[model samples]
Target: MREELLISRRGFMLAGGAALAAAARAGGGPAAGGVPNVVLCMTDDQGWGDVSYNGLKAIRTPALDAMAAAGLRFNRFYAGAPLCSPTRGSVLTGRHPNRYGCFMPGSPIRAQEMTIAQALRRAGYRTGHFGKWHLNGVSGPGKPIAADDPLSPGKMGFDEWLSVSNYFDTDWTFSRKGELEKHVGDGSDVIVAEALKFIAAAVREGRPFLAVIWFGSPHSPHKPLPEDQKAAGGSAYYGELVAVDRAMGRLRSELRALGVADNTLVWFNSDNGATPAGSNGPLRGHKATLWEGGIRVPGIIEWPAGIRKPATTDVPACTSDIYPTVLELAKVTVPNQITPLDGLSLVPLIEGRMERRAAPIAFWHNPARAGGQLNTATGHAALCDNRYKLHRLPDGNWQLYDLVEDISEKRDLAAEKPEIVQQMKTELLRWIDSVAASYRGEDYRRAGIPFAPATRPAGPATAPAARPRRQQRQQARRRRQ
Candidate 1:
């Protein structure tokens, strides 16, 4: 549990201006293939400060830094959760990982939830996933996914996938649609190459594509290529990053050579916070905490046909925003779509019409999921409502911070801002209940898992609104009387 803290500080950020502000909520602009191609790229354990554009001097990230300079960069980007599997699930589902019982690494994504890949593929977009796929409930060293594995990407919506169980280093093995294949090269380079082939085929076929490239590098075992390791002054972590940057450069080059660069939107970010070998910049905490460092990651979106100039926004965003954003951009509306998505479309944000993020990003991690009950009171939960962050401690107490003034989370403003705390707390509780409902199979329509309409307004799941405690108490007393 946590308690009240105080805060009062001021911070300055960059001003932004861009061209081509579109009014269309869907189909951002005309693309080469009628709809823009999507390339979603994510790295493992890389931090917010891991990029040169973020003021990092430890390693070179020219490719990623260039992307930030050419497109829209997010100053306050977050992973859905502080770990790999949970955040990955957020990207695919546009919902909090807890909503689908994907609370931690190696957690199996429930079959009932619809994925972005599934929604897009149904709309005739070729979908493919490459590299790390820990959502199948497998762990240990990266291994080729099994054909019979019900949770494989093939079963989860992707038409083709060259994936592994978890993180893979150099010269690793993968399941190319369940067929074993070995690759020799830097891990990042290897996956990007595979993804490029997928993209090329989609382009030749004149089909818009959704390529989910999850790179398994700089996570653990610190295995970098000999040349890359030497180039990094013998630090394997930085070495892995070198290969990552080069691989990204190659991907972009191939996109241009294929004449799809202008319309292809490449969204780049990390799964979670940095390890000890990486940097979270000035933020506090690491890897698994609810702090800014653990959840905040480097986010960049490069859409040449849409975003014409380099711009940056301090508006807070999360990985959950990916699914809805992609779907809207592609104009792919799912039939009987799942309601109350935790993500909001960032199309406006990319078009420069968005001044502030509309909804708060809810990060939920309740790992007591394998047979054990979800202990929201003792598990982790946090709400990033614009400039403020409210963390629910394991002991069921609360801690609030003004992230604008205190980026390091040094101040706790819960005591000073009781009204704000109460309001955000109400929203958090409402959101938690919604996630719990989804966890109980209420959102799933099936024989065993009955589809039940939501009885109450899940206010906090989309927008931040408060029903006062005093009024609630009065209503309760009247009901009792």
Candidate 2:
């Protein structure tokens, strides 16, 4: 795509209004009204019960708890996948992580995929991304940056980005434009501060904005800000989360103070379920699994002007819903060239009218190995159609779960429920074939690399070096898996 294809900030909003009208017409909904500003706050690796509202006794997340009480909490909300990059990718693309070639952590989102930012940009929204941006750079066991990777937030549609290549703690480097600037402060707080600035500017300009504030908190290398550490008493991990919570409080206060809180559809969620340090409440699996604990996440949607009930809904929603949800709320239209969104909008649920969720949610992970980490692995896929779930792993592993009754997934009913499993497996395989055919591989780091000046490989002498590269990738995949 050419840079000229980019919709200007002003034109994007006008287009969004048009797009909303179109979507409304297509959905047979009432005519669209003024678009709502969107604020999507995602915490890294935050657990379901980490917040007090979710029944955590230790962590003090007053702001999040209050937000939950003030809005609609999704009792069965889930991330698009079990890992960060994949879930984040789903948020942007309105599709399964596998479709966008982001099936694992540190993988790049396909440059060809249409991102939520890009879609919203077409509708005239001022977009900005803050915090972790792991969809760029080299994926192997090296620390060097890939200068030409086309998967950064900028390429994905955000006009302004103050982000890191991946998760960072206190006192991190900010990738501004093409250069890096050292910034002092807790990573979570810094990201929120930047987001606040973007929100402030959008408000001043009288334009609808989509500000994605992704906190790099509570992830690994758990270093908490001093004040937050103190607040957590003795646990530094809890301290990092405390910092994120406090910063979130500041963000909400600022939004309300600026009079945008009522108009802004503020959505808070995590990329996936918790890590070992955190709790997934009653859920089963953690991080990289097909179990509920790996995908189920705490989610809240706060819009004072719209959702007046402040209710809880058992309606199953996934991270994929974010892209279309924001687009629908903002009155943004999906361009003709853009692929159809795999996610259904949750506007009806938000409006408190939708009774039962009908569509199935699907998940798949196919990790690729490179150097020393579990770069990636291959897994089939799974889908939740209403109450039943069917999983088809690459190793021919298949299982079925009755999510409503057995959210833990401790027992597999596939043997007894052979008919349902086969039906769902057929559906899953069809999707897999379609998606895999176009998946050329997510080596975004190698995208713009020059072809070694067409230099011939040093034949026999280089054979041993090639073997080591393969071996290193194998080892990395093992560690990650």
Candidate with top TM-score is 1
Q: What is the C-alpha lDDT of each candidate?
A: 0.80, 0.72
Weakest 10 consecutive residues of candidate 1 by summed lDDT: 11-20
Worst 10 residues of 2 by lDDT: 454-463
Cα lDDT, model 1, residue 223: 95
TM-score of each: 0.86, 0.80
lDDT of 1: 0.80
Can you write out model 2's per-residue Cα lDDT over 278-353, one digit (the tens) per residue?
8898888788887788888989998888888889988889899998888878777764434435678999999988
The candidate maximizing lDDT is 1
